[model samples]
Target: MNQELLKLDQVSKTFRNDKGHAIQAVKEVSFRVMRGHSIGIVGESGCGKSTLARLITGLTPLDAGEILLEGNRICGLSGKAQRQVYRQIQMVFQDPYSAISPRMPVGTFLTEGLVHFGMISRKEAGKEAERLLQMVDLEPQLSQRLPHQLSGGQLQRVVIARAISIHPKLVILDEATSALDVSVQEQILELLVRLQKEYALTYLFIGHDLAVVRSITEEILVMKNGAIVEKLPAKTLVRDAREDYTKQLLSAVFSVREFQEP
Candidate 1:
């Protein structure tokens, strides 16, 4: 078996409330992500799934525990080290429009990371920008377009392309498809599955949509109140969840099936 690509050991994050109370966003959470595998973290709205992504991507400082990437401790790196971590792991945020810069064209948006990492020349970045667009199932000609011109689904495709432009080892999708319509959501999931196979990408996909999560994840981690209550294979979690919370989540997801006459 392959070694783990990412590890979160007893990770915890706390926020101070306005009332001067400490809100533990993630409490002693631990998990491992092997290379080329997709791990879905799913729970209800306030279950801290997104907060966990923020912690993994270094957007928020952890109150406790360690996060290891490729078996290297990266939770406290700074300067050049931090930049290196930033390069190897990228994030596609929940809102594509908000995640992408409004000021830059699609080509510029994709190439900027290449330029920042010195992975390619400015001219090369410009050329590869078009390819990146195509890779995401978007027309290369769309490179000239601005964010406002693209539909919500199109914006998300751009976001996915930009995230993979650097060819990062890990990509965190924080509810990336939640903003799209049903057809577009299917397209995005197909795109993600294709890319994962092609690039051997390891993803930590965080979301509330169990169906959406099930579509992509090989394993599922079910969370509640900042702690993981159950960890099971994706199909097992769907059909045979053991926890009350997991059953509740599965109930909500399979509720769609309840409406159909069989």
Candidate 2:
């Protein structure tokens, strides 16, 4: 068996109202992600899927529990340690249009982080940026254009390229393909599969669509009302979900497909 690359032990998060009413966003979520495998988290909006992503990425402080990377606690790290953590864990958000700056050229967007971390010099970044763009199947010239100049699918590939440029051990893709057209979504998914095989990447893919999640992930986690209600192999999710919520979601997805078929 592969050694666990990441672990969440009873991880929890809460947000309190001004009146002191605590609303739990994530409740004691626990899981392990092994190297070179993908775990999918699926839920409707407001089910704490995005909050879990935020907690994993250190965008927010954890109110409770532990997050570990390679058996080391990642919570409460100093700035220097956090920067090191970032090199191991990266995220690609849902919207390419807003995820990157409109004013920054694609080359700058891809290379700035590498240069900031002293991994590569500014002079060497251009060639490295072009290399990454090629890895994502984009022409090197596209790096000269701004974010707004590319179509949504093209910008998303750039985002994926930047996320992988640092060679992260784990990549959290929170609805990374949700913004593109259906055909574009398939292309991006294929690209992700290729990249993962080439890089041995462990993915934490968060999305609402069961079909999309099932297509790329090995394990599927079903969340409802801020808690995981079911966990199953991706191949069995539609046929063997023990939770009504999971069944309902699967039904809805299939219903739409049937309704749209010619």
Please write out the lDDT profile of model 1 over residues 1-262, one tens digit for every residue: 3879999999999999899998888999999999999999998888899899888878788988999998898887778988898899999877888977787898898888889999899878767988998898888888999999899998898889888988899999988888889898999999999999988899989888888898899899999999999998987666778898888877766565667857
**Candidate 2 lDDT for residue 227:** 92
Candidate 2, residue 193: lDDT: 99
Cα error, candidate 2, residue 130 (Å): 1.1
The C-alpha stretches of model 2 lying farther than 4 A from their native spots are: 255-262
* TM-score, cand. 1: 0.96
Per-candidate count of clashing residue pairs (backbone under 3 Å): 0, 0
**How far off is residue 128 in model 2, in Å?**
1.1
Estimate candidate 1's alpha-carbon lDDT, on a 0 to 1 scale.
0.88
lDDT of 2 by residue, 26-81 (tens): 99999999999999999998999999988888888898899999999998776888
> Ten residues in a row with the worst lDDT in model 2?
250-259
Model-by-model lDDT, in order? Answer: 0.88, 0.91
